[model samples]
Target: MADTRPALPPLRDVIARHGLAASKALGQNFLLDEQLLDRIAAIPGPLRDAPAFEVGPGPGGLTRAILRAGAKLVAVERDRRCLPALAELEEAFPGQLRVISGDAMATDAHAEAGDGAHIIANLPYNVGTPLLVGWLSAQWAPLPWWSSLTLMFQMEVAERIVAKAGSDHYGRLAVLSQWRSDAKIAMKVHRSAFTPRPR
Candidate 1:
């Protein structure tokens, strides 16, 4: 059967119409590469019956990929400017996509995700470290609710996360991340891929 839904607008057009640009203070960077988005979305373990939680889903690039991969998505976007763009994604995916407009830091992501959830995100560089720490920290009376996390950070940060105790990149992040959950650097995104290059 042929699909009858409307096609998505070009990413550039969506950005222009919504006045969405990279914000330095917000650590904004738009990842327009569809292939990369798909790779990021695929990082979470098998989707089968699990839900996917995405943090800082600017412009819904990764959000769309998650839906395309067949997992239900809950996108936590802090920037209000990108809400309209994310709304378009929700419409495209129908009931599969849920957009939460608020700071991901302030929200209890694990509680919001409920049980049997997996997290995947290309997090903002500025706040990525803290967010990861918060996720690993013991929360509530028992522990975190999610089963696993597949997230993107800068190359340096990625190394740190996957580093072993004797490795140069190993540090507090490695210790904490190892203690709570199994983690590793799934991939490395090139600087040219992002809309606004941050070196």
Candidate 2:
């Protein structure tokens, strides 16, 4: 079926209109390229009619991609400045996107996304490892609430998560990620891709 909803404005335009400069304190780096966002959203495989969760959806770039991929997305965003931009997305993809304005660290993601949901995000840099650790630790019980996770991290952190047992980067993160599930480096995004290049 053809999508008849009104088109959303470009992400850059939304950011400019809203005065949403990436906050270093929040570790935000917006991804403006829709095609790249689509590829990231697809890393976890088919999202059609499935539930998906996103953390820190600045200006709703990845959120748009996930909606386009046919997922019912529940996004937790800490920055209030981005809510209006995301609201635009909510209107464009009605009934497909839900925005929660609060710290992702404090949010009950599992409850919000429901069971068997896919967790995908271009995670905020500072909290990325902490969030992943929390999710990885959840495996101590039965199966995790999420069916899969396809998250973006700095190159160093990415290596640590998927490093082999004998590799130099191998340690706690690798153990946590590999203990219960098959974890792999799904993709590597270049530094320049971010709105403000991460140092």
- Backbone clashes (count) for model 2: 0
Estimated TM-score for each candidate? 0.90, 0.96
Tens digit per residue, CA lDDT, model 1, 31-63:
888778878777775675468889988887777
Checking candidate 1 for backbone clashes, the offending pairs are: none
Candidate 1 residues lying further than 4 Å off, grouped into runs, are 1-6, 140-144
lDDT of 2 by residue, 28-125 (tens): 99899989998999989999999999999999899989999999999999999999988988988889999999999998888899999999998999
lDDT of 2 at 19: 98
RMSD of 1: 2.1
Which candidate leads the pack in TM-score? 2
